[model samples]
Target: MNAFQGRVTAALADPTLKTAIDRTTNTARSKRAAAIAAWPEFAQARELGRDMKDHVIANMEYYLTMFEANAVKTGAKIHWARTGQEACEIVVGICKAAKAKSVTRSKSMLGEEIGLPHALEAAGIERVETDLAEHIIQLAGETPSHIIWPALHKTREQVGELFRAHHTDPGELATVEEMVSSARRNLREKFMAADVGISGANFLIADTGAICTVTNEGNAELTTTPPRVHIVTAGIEKLVPSMVEAMTMLRLLVRSATGAELTQYTTFHAGPKQPGDVDGPEEFHIVLVDAGRTTMLAEGLAEMLRCLRCGACMNHCVVYRQIGGHAYGATYPGPMGSVITPSLDGLETSQDLPRACTLNGQCHEVCPVAIPLPTLIRGWRTKAWVQGYEPLHTAWALRIWEFFALRPVLYQLASNLALRIMPLFAKGGWISKMPLAGGWTRYRDMPIPQGGSFLAQYKKRQAAK
Candidate 1:
């Protein structure tokens, strides 16, 4: 097995990880259902959200240009990056120009996508993650396993232990609250002393040039408000035409993300602090990263762009709950990740992702923006097959199976022969061992063939009747 498959096997065997995933995702799914059911107009709202996103994607250039112009008008510099490397360079250059030694950051998936934390570290700048979950993972030297809840895979005991090792005065932090307090105390200094603050925007308004972020812990507000220089890194697809349009999306976002009516803090930072503003950054920069998004749009995979990043798809994904996000081995994980990863990283490297799904359509059912995730995953599989990305042995096996499958008489003869030989491996009507099928039998027993094939048995039954 390859590295990805090996990781998946390892994850499945980790009971603690599986338990964490099941509990957290089940709660999220239940809460989301309750919240959506409470809203009578949710269906209409979802349809409207889909339509709005489709419109923006269709006229992406116009909205993007408008946003840049308005953002520049508010004294915020707009930087465009066609790739992750360019985005990282732009951000690092901004920090270098500001002579920044440290940066306080909120939770930004786009940052994770471009490996921004590593990039900042390489430039000899201290990166402090302000979000609680993100800080926990950062202290543990681990990547986020979930989009909204970065430390979902970690238990409270695990977090307490991690804090005990990393935080000052480990003796003082015995409880969850104490650990949180210790983290806040440590991060408060970082927030004030940092030369630059980096954040991610959930949506960017084209008309008013505002960068909006919704957070439950309010860390994003501090991340954007403090420091001399502030940088917002976001995917190019996160654009809305107006505040009104954004509000509709936000309604769907909060409900789908945390199953709350709204997050605690829904902040809008419009082009840094104004002249009279008492508490705000001195400079603001927005780095829009394409990084294969445009390629996805060009290749008719634009539907994936409608994703709000709410993560509802994964919450309801059977495979995700079984093995968790780390098993996927990608920046993004679960159902949505299965589709997007291949699009961004290419099918050759991420081929296993598409095939990871059970294609139960639960992901599509739970998706707030109504993206057909299962269909898109299937599209990637088709692309893989057409491009000959499948393994040589598997490909040859399928071809041989198909040849017999297309011929009824030959297929029946083959099945009869297989049934006659089945007793060699069958034990108590279960095939515990099978040649060339160890992958399946290794996990669970396959039932032995009882009597003749179903087609042949059906003919015998008809004759009997």
Candidate 2:
């Protein structure tokens, strides 16, 4: 299993996030299922969004060039990074040039993907996470459990404990407010002393060369204003043709992610320092990290870039409920992450991800961008076979199955034979011992290959007619 899959397994099996996810999922189902179920609207919407993303991505070079030109015109500098390592190197170099001793960062997954803080730490820079959930996880020296709500694994009392322990002088007090106050006071010092502020952009407007951040706590502003140098890291596909499209994307983002009408703060920054802006970064640098996006784009899978990342899919997935983000072991997790992460990062490491889903299609339903995630997952399966990574036995079995199915006479004959033999194999109307089914039988009772095959039943009905 790759790090992401391993993490996913660990997360699903994790005593904390498991319980938290279980309760959260159950509660969401109880409280919001009616509303979510009403949205038979998701699948169609996702496809439309996917087309828009694909169209832009197919012409990505043009859009990127336009965005860069606008960004430069706005007096900010943009850097191109072919890989995560290169992106970090460029950011670290900027930090070094500014003589930055510390940086206060909002939740930037790309920064984590590149291990920016570790590199900065190596260069003697102190980095502090400014988001409340992130700060909790950071102080615990752990990764985030949930993408939007990082410390979802940590309960209220657990948070209180973390705060009391991390506080400069604390005997361990109680209450969410006190915990919040302590965290705020502690982070205030880091924010005040930091020389650099770093973040991730939700969308980079190609028309205006502007980047936008949406947050609940108003921390996005603080993250940029406290430091003389503000830097943003973004995946190259984060670009859109104009702020108009960006606005449309944002409208869908908040609603799809948390079911919110709007975020607390939706701030846009164009370039860097301004002539009369009293409080803003003196320099702004946007690092567009290609990593494996270009490869994905080239391979005709660029539709994944249409994601506005509202995270509604994660919120509603059965697997993500049973498991959590940490188990996926990638910067991105949940339904969209299953395909995108492995595609960007590689399946050799993320082989388990495609198998991790139940193929129930909740992800595709919730996806605002309409990326057919399950179909994308099936594509990954084909890619794995093409790479010679899949077992030959499984590949041969697939071919045999496909051949029979394509030949209707042979498939029906085989189905009739299996239906005839199925009853003999069944014990108590269930098959506990079956080939390639150990994983299935581990938790579920496999219904005896029932009522003959669907083809057999359908044929019998046709004959009756």
Candidate 3:
């Protein structure tokens, strides 16, 4: 087994983790199916969403320039980053210029991708996560396991214990609501005292120069509004031409992400606090990150740019459901991650990610933008094979199989010989163990051969007829 498969085997041994993943994924899958089924025009809407994103990607340079111009006009400073280190440096520079002592953040996967928290802490700036799930993992010194629901792998009991250990009081908070209230009380102080706030944008409007964020807890609003310095970090692909296109994408995003028509709050910020505005930031900054996106665009993997950061693909993925997200061991996880991680991190480092999937195509079926995830994964597999990255045993086995497959007489002779000799190893119509097939038979029995070759069966049937 490869390293990725080894991790998956280890994950499968944890029954508690399996139960948590199964319950969460099953619930999310049911809700998303029901939500999509309720809308008669969802199919057309999905196609339209895909088309809009494709257009933006094709004309990415033009839209990015237009966005920068409009944002400058609205008095927002824009910064472009070509690498993760550059992105982190830009953020730290802004904080340092503002003399920020404490920074509060809303959940941004871009922030995670660039390792912003470590950068901030290394600079002696306090970094606080305001989102509930993010806050939980942050306190636990762990990374997000899923995109939308970062802590889905943790049970309520686990969260309660985490809160008890982290919170000041050891009070008996027996229910989820009490635990949430405890976390809120602790995070509220951080929000009020924050000197700088960082957030991720769901959609960036090129025409209006708006940065849009969607959240259930309203923490993103607080993160953007209360602090004196507000910074938005987002992938370059988040840009849309207008509010209409943004709205259409939002419709698909919320439904695919959480099975909701809309999140509790969807806030849009065009610039810093206006002259008449009561509560808003004094300075606004938008950072466009292009760590590996330009490379992806040049390659044929630009189809992945259509993703809305919705978790539906992972929610419905059989491999993700079985092994959970942590086994992938990358920033993103599941089917979409399998395709994009290899492109961003290179096929050499992330080769196991593509092999983690079953290529069952369920991810393609449920994708809000209809990205061909399975086909992209197969492309990676082909790339790996062509580059001679295939395991030695697998390569030899395929060569042997191909040699016999090309010669029908030898194939039939070998098959008949196997059929006659296999009974020596059969017990109760099953093979309990085998030398070369331990991977398959280790956990379960493999069924013994039941009849002669398919060609023999066909010939006998023809003669009887």
- The prediction achieving the highest TM-score against the true structure is 3
* Per-residue accuracy of model 3 over 282-372 as CA lDDT, tens digit each: 9999999999998888778889999999989999988888788889988899998998888878899898889878889999998989999
- Taking the tens digit of each residue's C-alpha lDDT, what string does model 1 give over 332-420? 99999999999888889999999998999999987888999999999998999999999888699899999999999999999999988
State the lDDT of candidate 2 residue by residue for 54-148, as single tens digits. Answer: 77887889999999999999988899999988998999999999999899899877677777767777888888899988898888888776667
TM-score of each: 0.90, 0.86, 0.92
Identify the superior model by lDDT, candidate 2 or candidate 3.
3
Error of 3 at 428 (Å): 8.8
Candidate with better lDDT, 1 vs 2? 1
| Models sorted by TM-score, best on top | 3, 1, 2
lDDT of all predictions, in order shown?
0.90, 0.78, 0.90
Colliding residue pairs in candidate 2: 4-328, 4-329, 7-326, 7-327, 8-327, 8-328, 46-370, 47-370, 257-310
Name the weakest run of 10 consecutive residues (lDDT summed) in model 1. 167-176
| Segments of candidate 1 deviating more than 4 angstroms | 170-175, 408-438, 441-465
Clashing pairs for model 3 are none
lDDT of 1 at 401: 96
Which residue pairs overlap in candidate 1's backbone? Answer: none
